[model samples]
Target: MTWFREGEELDDEDIVSKVDYTTSKLLIRKASLSDVGTYTCKFESEDGHKVEAEFVLYIYKGPSFHDTTIYHEFLEGADGVVLCMVTGQPAVDVQWLKDKEPIPSTHRSQLTIRSVVRADYGEYVCTAKNKIAESSATFMLHVFEPPEVFISGDQHSVNVGERVAVSCNVTGYPQPDLHWLNKQNGQELDMAGRIHVLDGLLEIKDVIPADGGLYSCMAVSTSGNASRDVSIHTQPGPPHYLTVTPGPTSVLFTLKTFPINGGTPIKSFVLQWRKNAIEKWEETIVAASDVLAITDLRPYTKYTVRMAALNNVGRGQFSIENTVRTEGKREPDSPAISTDQAKVEGNSFSVPLEQSDNGGSPLLHLNVKYKEEAEKSEWHKMQLPSDAKSVNLKDLTFGSDYHLEVEAVNSNGSSIPATFNFTVPEQPVSSRMTKGTVAGIVMLIFLVVFLAVDATCCYRNRCGLLMAVAGKLSRWKDPGLKKVEEGEGTTNGDVTLKAISKPRRSIQQSGVQTISKEAGHLTEVTCDKAPLTKNEKLHPTTDA
Candidate 1:
């Protein structure tokens, strides 16, 4: 290996061969400057002979830094348009990444964003790269808010002579401009007179019918524009009341007329009503000043009434309807009363009474009376409940008999009393007894029989038990009997026999009493002669 100076590789000499080389040809490979500075070649013979050669190589330099340029400051909402220009030693491949995601190149694919919104503000990168090096440029995108409109006050319903105001509210990066327009005019409103534009509000003062129109507010921004529209109307006045005076089938209705406060005088009035059960309306036309008198109406019928006023523009909306019925002067005919057996509810007798009339007249009053007997002097008259169809005999005593009658009354006069009779009698008292008493009595009889049978069986059983206990003692082994004590508190050897002795003596005493009675001998067993143990243990007889 050998070291060479600057420009030395261009003048370096070729290697010389030895003269004893015997005219042998030497092979030298061409080396360019790219293979610079150091090189070594050595040959070794079989007997340790050696040969050597050295060379240097160098190359020229090219451009280093890239001229990839990026464009900036795009207007917001301009479809995200952008430009990237690049210059490099070797033309590099250009690629785009938005938020770290590769962007595909298609016809719609440009550096532009579609439907750009506030959330679309972010960093976008353009990369120029090759096998050796890579570089990227980041452009920060900014999205401005679009413009919009806002209404000032709620304008659903506005009264006449009252002011209504509307406004346009907007926002943008460059602060949007507001405009007002009457869509009916199709032109921009330069100033406010009828419709005043101050700040963002379009105020309509002392609103009149003529002030009604389509109002629009528009907002323009560098990003976009927005608009909204609302309609205005003049409100009607408070309503008037109409009165109807009666004639046969016709009635005259008088309206309390008044001029519209903030409006023109009414020109015409419309009167409408409907007959009972009728679906369609009957209209009457009259001068706005004239009172309405409808003719040929149904007698004694209900009618729903309504009216409206008209001016030069059109009809003001109708007033709320007030219902009225025609008058028929006929008096109510006598109401016939029909009566039946009445149920006596406490202090009252409820009776079904029916009365009917073609004309609508309420029964004003009724009266009732009763007779104690067929020979009673006169009907016992009592004014009945005003609404009662029946009368009650509150003062009558139980088991008493009485006949009842009722009379109907209206505005004209009372009807003849209709008579119906019923005999009031004492209610049966047996109904007061409860089933529990009979059940208790039956259960008592059954219990007595059951106890008598059980006692007799228990008596017979006692005799057998006593005999068994005696037999067991008599058959006891001597070893078991030895357990008995001998003296004082001990049971004596005669205790069993003595306990058994009384029962046998009782049988004998009963035999003596029976024998005495059969033989016609009146023999009394004296207390002194009675067996002491038997008398003590048997019934334990007492002096009483």
Candidate 2:
């Protein structure tokens, strides 16, 4: 017996042949696609008679996919379609399924996703069905999400010549590529310069006012890209805050500002803070200074703080809000008052103070009470500023002792009272003068008055009180000299004197010229222009 396949004689050693009395058989093993063809069996006898039989064979294959790729990827929110390209000897029916559930509108071996979402990602099964067999293939579907990015902080404040770091938080299916950009120039940040970026963190060294601006943090990936903006604020115009400290009952904020606006320096800052969700704002004002404390706040509360800069112009726009929470309630500690250092000047007294321990709260002010040491005197109350170094009491009575008490007050309550006694001094005066000194001053006044009278009399009458005294002294010395009596014949002061009417007569014997009239005790003398009375006869006559 002989076997032939596809019109060709079979030559494989694996073919088995058998012969019997009335039948001849040929067997073929391991039949495959290549073995599908016409087969012929030949019978030959020793008497030279030959016969051949041909049989047609057909091998029908099941359905199979064309491509070997079993994984698919698509961006989220994008339209995508996955087709199962199948082949087989006979045309087959195709269907699609996912998670063991049939997919709708997938009769054409194609799975369509409109606006792909994360829920569309998973294993997708494509099955081809035929009369003889059914085959299936699983392809993994992955949906890529765009990088969702956020900055650590929306705004970061820093002084000139400072360092700052900003971080970006990103999440995506595929890790995204991060880049930091400066919005000032709209350029990629220079990693070789003062700024650098590493692992989504941007670090800037020695930042300047020019470096302060909006920075873009971007994340790029195969799917898509996303970005967030960060603000780096410096000084001038508006102020960027530096520090915020919250206590039990107060909030303290310190803002960093340069001393310049548009050629004008900033004069002040308007700070505003309030509860997180409240609309009405609470304002606290004190003597205009650098104290930026907002006191008398509820404890354990969340607050939002902001501020605006004030210059020659009105207040600028308010700054970004900052969320803060005050600490829990805690009573303030007692303060120390330096009563020993108290000072008194005339009608007023001032008591000094030392910095106090405010515990968990802030010192609101100081209270002082005092009263005259005298019995049944009421106490007088006075208040001082929180930042005052001393408390002063004016219009106080001098030369009096008083009971004084000083207590430090805070939001919680007052501290232990410091009690002491103080004596107010009177107006200052020097030591009293001696009795002898007083008597001497009186005698000196009398002498001055008498001298003034004598000088006045002498000017009009050529006579004075000293002259009268001299006359009286002379009379007393001799007790024989006649003393001028008051109102005698004619007082010089009372009478008018006449002019000289007589010429002098000279006595040539002594070269002397005497007045024509003389008093009883003396005579007034005069001089003549004649030389020694012309050296002539000695005569005493009244002639012109």
Candidate 3:
């Protein structure tokens, strides 16, 4: 057995061959391109007869790259190309991958991008394969973008001793460095002063008029630098929002505020007033922040008021004049009264007292005026004390409509009159109670005559209507006085009273003595011994 190259026998000791009864085998270790050729195997019988077979051995190699890993850089929106240099015996098939994900490619061993974005950055693989083996190459793509800047506000207006801030936003692939500059001079602003930059913002504290200028904000990066500008202005304006209140003797001036003071602080104000257009002007200087009061003014007068503010730049223009009139001596307000407050009694109007305003002066008196509504007559007038509690008008004509007016007077004037209207109710007919009184008097006279006759009959004959009533009443006397001893009463002109230990009322430790009244005599007798004999005269016992 033999292995051959280009029909020449291979004699390297590393090649081994083995012959068996029906087959021949050859083994080669670490074969190379140089060993690619035609090879033959020989077989012989026991006789001198020979058979030969041949084969063409072609050596194959897998793909390889010049660089295993590479880095590529591109700006945004630019094209990018990565090439894989490979060597192999057979043709190689190529495929592309981005971040470990497959990407279809038209060219073998090459990857192309028409437009690159930030998403295109990161690891990329170029895979190649042949009949023998597969290999890959790696590329790291980086996309860059230039810096762009955006400022917040275009302009600003500030007051004196105020704080102001301006901000800007920057965008770029890599973070940008920010700077604030004075646009008037291309110099960077100080970082350790009242005006400085913090976190992409430009700030100014304790602002002055000089601080008003064009400011620039810049952002810098490896790709590019970007800038934007802003402007600030300062100016002083006139005072605003003035109000005036008038009283009887004075005028109050209210100066609300001034909005734009430029960059100067206001210290004071000057107020000028005139009694009228013909009179000379009087001016007073007051500290800032005041509700000024000018007193001692004559009542019922008109005046013109104007004011100006004082700042570092001097006084500004005067505000428009405000015309005000002081109040005159005024009549008191109307008293709170209603028709219901003046109640209507029979044939009269009862007006309940309610104190009214006295026009800010001591009250002189309260005057009441009244009249019938349907009659063309002069009103009846009445006067009452200032503190009177009520007003009553009586003897008013029934079924007549009436009107009443009430007012309070002071030294200044009379207050407004409060009026009420009501109608007097009609008088009713004589009542049944009067008739009942006449009937009751006639019955009383007849009862008195009957009582006189009954008394005369009882005195003369010892029996009459009143005598029967007396007997019946005596039988029903209080049982507690019943008896020391019980005795029967006689029908003839005698009354036998029992002398008992019990008295008419329940009193303790008491004795009883009997007293009987006869036809012409009252006698005291002892009933404890025995009952009196019928018609027997019992002598009066003075000591009994």
As for candidate 1, its clashing pairs are 33-58, 35-57, 36-57, 37-57, 79-113
Clashing pairs in model 2? none
Ranked candidates, highest lDDT first: 3, 2, 1
After the best TM-score superposition of candidate 2, give how far the Cα of residue 139 lies from its true spot, in angstroms.
2.8
Which lDDT tens digits does candidate 1 get at residues 49-139?
8876664434323223334334444445556676665444345567778798877882221376776766666778877765557766776
What's model 3's overall lDDT?
A: 0.71
Q: Tell me the tens digit of each residue's lDDT in model 3 across 280-372.
A: 878887777654666566788888888776665556567788888887666665555544677777787786777765554446788899998
Give the Cα error of residue 291 in candidate 2, in Å: 41
How many steric clashes between backbone atoms does each model show? 5, 0, 1
Please, what are the lDDT tens digits per residue for candidate 2 over residues 312-362? 434445567777888876655545568778888768888777766675666
- Residue 179, candidate 2: C-alpha displacement in angstroms: 9.0
Pairing residues by index, what is the TM-score of model 3? Answer: 0.35
Sort all candidates by TM-score, best to worst. 3, 2, 1
Task: Name the runs in model 3 displaced over 4 angstroms.
Answer: 1-57, 67-69, 159-161, 236-544
Judge candidate 1 against the unseen true structure and give its global Cα lDDT, from 0 to 1: 0.57
- Name the top TM-score candidate: 3
Task: Output the better candidate (1/2) by TM-score.
Answer: 2
